[model samples]
Target: MHFDLADLRLFIHIAESPSLTQGAKRAFLSPAAASARIKALESQLGSRLLYRDNRGVDLTPAGQRLLQHARLIMRQVEYLKNEFTAYGADAAGHIRIFANTTAVTEFLPEVLAGFLAQRPGVTVDLQERLSRDIVRGVLDGSSDLGIIAGPVNASGLQVLHFSTDRLVLAVPRNHPLSTLKHVKLKDTLRYQHVGLHEGSTLLSFLREQVEHLGETLSLRIQVSSFEAVCRMVETGVGIGVIPESAAKRHSRTMDLTIIELDEEWAIRERSMLVRDLDALPGCVRALIDTLLPASGAEPPSNTPT
Candidate 1:
């Protein structure tokens, strides 16, 4: 079987248009020519792709499935072009990034995975550092950029609003605190908890926050990862504080509920920082573009607030 970009584009046009003739016109092909191409495509795939009548054309089941994939392939091609076109060809290099616990643990891995998959020439040295330290690293040339949470005087760095890091409490469905929408960290300190294992960046950060209140987390059990903590919480071992994203993912299958923390620190904007956006390398620029997709994020009107 033979399939190509031209076939995919022609198929997508036909699937999207009101009639086969219009689709062919949009694709800059004669209607007869387009019809022959579609028949050929159908023969190659061993399936009927569309149903034609006097009124118009409608996609068959196989056509619908093909349409889905064809659209995705077109989108990925467009994205690849955009990633490379902003600067010239992508340059091979390493991007040193210092990010906070939330970015490092919850979001960066998945975000980086897709970016790395497309650009094999690029490599990243990612380290989890505190927000202030991340800012300092970007400032002093220690790193190309940083993803930071919470506030510091990020005066010299170029800040692009990243994801929101909302730390929420995961409680058993029938637990007393489950009825409450928000619970302050200080109020929850008295209860037993399930926490990430020692040396976990987030756990260390939480320890410092609690220490500020002259109290400590009463960790009854320690787990290696967020999912484990949620599993323990589901069994009524103890409540756990984890990223809302992680909690929501686990809550679907577990008997758990997420309660927001009644503290300013609980909700903070995670911002991407670079010393100079204009002066950045092409690879760094491409990485930034991939991370800040148009959906679920606005084009960053950058400045430290």
Candidate 2:
């Protein structure tokens, strides 16, 4: 038996849509033509693929199996198309990168800028996600590379050292906590806090830590970025927890103080993760090399809190 990509494509469309007519519309084929294609596919396989109903169609057992393989095959086809297109476009390459807020905000700008400058033909698609989600994306082949901070379960991917940063308490210069060089999270929880907005990885981590301590964060204000949080703290709105890199940078120009967090989790080591280093395209590999530190170079230093 012989089947074409069109058959598999039509099968997937039919399986996903509420009706064959709708699927056919999406596939740019007439309803009758789509139905005929499905019938021919079923006949070739000698198995019923879908059960028709008034509302739509449901996949049969054989259809479900085929759906799985079809999705995988489509993914491979897309990859092949992109690879070939890059080759035809004068050695251009594309890389997809997913990173957490800390890595995106505090680390990647300079590194990515240099990488892009050196390799003019390479294009990057960058997305911001939580470290855990970044790990999942890399493992599922949705992302070519991931830069993450905090702890993550990176079991199946190759992990490499990327950078190191620390969480710090940012306060107005005259605030009570500013007098202290380091403080535990619990000690600062008693005061109103300026926080990153909800759904931020740093905010989520802070909330989880507070929950583990059987307490709640007394959030006075929530803002979208570290710069906003620092500004709020500088105006004495409330103390804020932010990366030391950001706090230090802001303190140079603002009346802000950075106090090191006394918890073990405060010192975060960011990591770069990939599904397989060896399988990366030449241009992608070159970009990776640029991101990595030179052999025997000093490890990233934590900002003075």
Off by over 4 Å in 1: 1-88, 199-201
Q: How big is the positional error of residue 196 in model 1, measured in Å on the Cα after superposition?
A: 2.7
Across 1-305, the per-residue lDDT of candidate 1 in tens digits comes to 55789989999898889999999999999999999999999999999999999999999999988986776566446435545653345545568889866677777899889887887777789987766678777765667778876665767767888567689999998998989998999988878999987766678778999999999789999987788999999999999999888889889888898999998888867678887786666778888887888225676876644
Q: For model 2, how does the per-residue alpha-carbon lDDT over 49-84 read when each residue is reduced to its tens digit? A: 999988899999999878867755665565456556
Prediction RMSDs, each to the true structure:
17.8, 5.8
**Whose lDDT is greatest here?**
1
Candidate 2's C-alpha runs over 4 A off are 1-91, 294-305
Residue 268's lDDT within candidate 2 is: 89
Alpha-carbon deviation at 263 in model 1, angstroms: 1.7
